[model samples]
Target: MKMGWRELIRMKQRFTLMAIVTTLIVLLILMISGLADGLAYDNGAVVRNLPVEHVALSQDAEGQLTRSFLEQTDQPAGTEALGVQSMVLEKQNGTKDDVTVFASPVDTVYGPKELATLKPGQVLVDTQYAKQSGTAVGDTITDFRTKATFEIVGTVSDGRYSHAPVLWTTLETWKAWQDKMKTNYVSAFISQDPIKTDLATYTQQQIVEQVPGYAAEQNSFQMMRIALVLIGSLILTAFFYILTMQKMKQLGILKAIGIRTRTIGQGLVLQVFLLTTVSFAISLLLIWTIGQLLPGDLPFRFEWTTSFGYGGLIVLTAMLGGLIPLRALKKLEPADAMGGMTG
Candidate 1:
C-alpha cells in the first residue's frame, strides 16, 4: 500500500489534479448529505426525541399540522380535553423573531415548566432559540397579539419543530392570545403505549410520512441526493477512463512483458482505493475546517454514521471509476504498440 501511494505521488501533477477534483466532488456530496440529515433532524428531532409513545393528529387535519387540529377521536381516551391556546412570540432583539408556540395541556407533557426556575408568567423555549435571540435566563417578551408580556423561563435544550424554534406555553395561554376555541388542531399527541387501549400504533416514519410537509421536504432532499450520486458516477467514470488512456502505453508494455491483465487490473484497483482514501480523508478535514468557520445557523451537521456511509460511497465510486478502464484494457491490441502513434 505504501509503495502504491508513492507511485501515485510520483505522478504528482496528474494525480494531484485528479485527487483534487475527486476530493471536491466527494466533499460537496458528503456535505450536502450532512445538510440533508441536519434538515431532517431540524424538522423532527425535538418531537421525535420526546418521551412520548404516540402522536395524535385529527383525521380531518390531512396530516398537515398548520391546517389540522386534533379531533376528539384523535385525543387519548383517558386524557381530558383542553381548550385551544396560541401565543405570539418573537426572538429577543431579532428584527423578525421566528418562534413557534404550541397549545398543550396544562397538566400532561406540555403542562407548566417542570423546572423550579420556570414560572407561570413565562414559558420554555428551545435552547437554539434562546441562543439565537440572545435572551437571558429571565427576560420580558411581549405577546404581540395579546399586548401582554411573558417571561422567559429556564431554557430547554430540546425544542424545535419543522426546523423552526419552538416555545412551550399552556393551552390557556394559546387561547388568551390566539383566540383558538374548541379546536382539535392540537396537531399531534405523544403518549406511551397501552395507548388508551383504543388508538393504533404507527412508526415514526409512518407518522412523519403523514405530515403534510414531510413528504415534499424529504422528496426534495432525496432528489438532490440522487442527482449528486449520478454526477459522482459520471465523474468517476470519466476520470478513470482518461487516466487509463494516458497509461495505455504502460499497459501495452506490461502486457508485452508477460504481465497478466489480472496483475495490472489489481494494480489499477489498488491505485483507485488509495486515491479515494486520501481524497476522502482530506475532504473530511476540509469539511471540519469549513464548519468551524461558519455560523451556527448554517445547516450542515451529521452523525458519525453519515461520514462512514459517505466514505463507503467514495470507495465504491472510485472502484466503479477504475472499472471503466478495464473495458479499454480488453480493447487494447498488443500489435498497436509495435510502432505507431496512438490517440
Candidate 2:
C-alpha cells in the first residue's frame, strides 16, 4: 500500500485525470440506474402493492388488462373483480390530467391500502395525485368521460399505474360511469388463494411488463447500463496499460535492486483499487447531493443496495484492468525492461 501511494503521488496528474474520468462514468451509471427504477415504480407501483399472488385475465385478451373483460357471471366465487380505466380528472381550474381509475370492492383484499368502507360517489386518490392537482380531502373532481363528479375521501401512498396516479373508487361508482353493458364486466380478478380456471394467470412481474411502454423503457435503460459498464472497463484498462508502460524503466531498476515481480504487481493492483474506491465514493456523494436538489416530481429513485452492488462491480473491473499490465510485467526481463523497448 505504501509503495502504491508513492507511485500515485509521483504520477499525480495522470492518475487524477483517470480518477475524474472514472468518477464521471460511475455517476452516469448510478443516475441511469435510479431513473430506470423510478420509471418502473411509476408505471407499476399499483400492481406491486397488490396483496394477491396472481391476477387472472381473460384468455382472449392475451394478458392485457385493458383488453380483458370478465362479466359478473364469469367471475369465480370469492375472487375480487377489479375495474380499471384510463380517464381524465378535470381540475376546478379547468385544467385536466390523465389518471388510471381503479374500482374495487371496498375493504376487499385487492384494495391497495386499508381503509374504512368507501361510500358510493366518494373516491380515494394517490398522494402523488393529490399533491399534483392540489386537491384535498372533501374536494370534488369531475370525470371527463361521463361528466360525473366524485368527492375525494382519502389518499393512499404508492398508488400509481401506467405512469399515472391511481384513483380508487367503489364498484358501484364505477358502474354508474360506464355503459350498462360494460358495467357488468371487470378488467381482471384478484385473489389471495390459488385460482383454478381456464383464464390465463400472470404473476405481478409479468403484469408489470404488460403495462404500455414498460418493457421497452426498461430494455433501453438496461442497454445503456451495459454499454456504460463496457466503456468504463475499457477506459480503466487503457489508462493502466499506458501508465505501466511509461514506468517500465523504473520497474526494471527496482527489479535490478532485488524487488520481486510479485511485490510490484501487488502494488499496481493496490493503486488501481485505491483510485477506484475514491472515485466511487465521490460519485456516490455527488449522486446523493444531486438527488436532494432535484424536483419532487422528477422520476429519480435511489436505492443503497443498487449503489453498493454497482460499486462492487466497479472494484472488480478495476482489478481486472490492473491484471492486464501485471501479465505483461510478469513476462518482462529486467534487462529488456531497462532497454525501454515498446512491445
The best candidate by TM-score is 2
C-alpha lDDT values of all predictions: 0.66, 0.84
Off by over 4 Å in 2: 9-14, 112-117, 180-183, 340-343
For candidate 2, give the lDDT: 0.84
Cα lDDT of model 1 by residue, 172-246, tens digit: 555455442333335555555434533334455555565436668878987887687678768877887887887
CA error at residue 47 for candidate 2, angstroms: 1.2
Give candidate 1 misplaced runs (Cα > 4 Å): 1-6, 71-98, 103-121, 134-138, 145-149, 172-185, 194-201, 205-212, 340-343
Q: What tens digits encode model 2's per-residue C-alpha lDDT throughout 1-343?
A: 6688898998899889989999999999999988998898888889888887878898887666788888867777668888888888897779898999888876667785443467778888899778877889998889886788888888988568888889888788888777633456789987877777778988878888889889999999989988888888888888899989988888887887898889999899998899999999999999888888888778898878888788779778878977999888888788887785444
Candidate 2 residue pairs in backbone clash: none
| Best candidate according to lDDT | 2
Compared with the true structure, model 2 gives a TM-score of 0.90
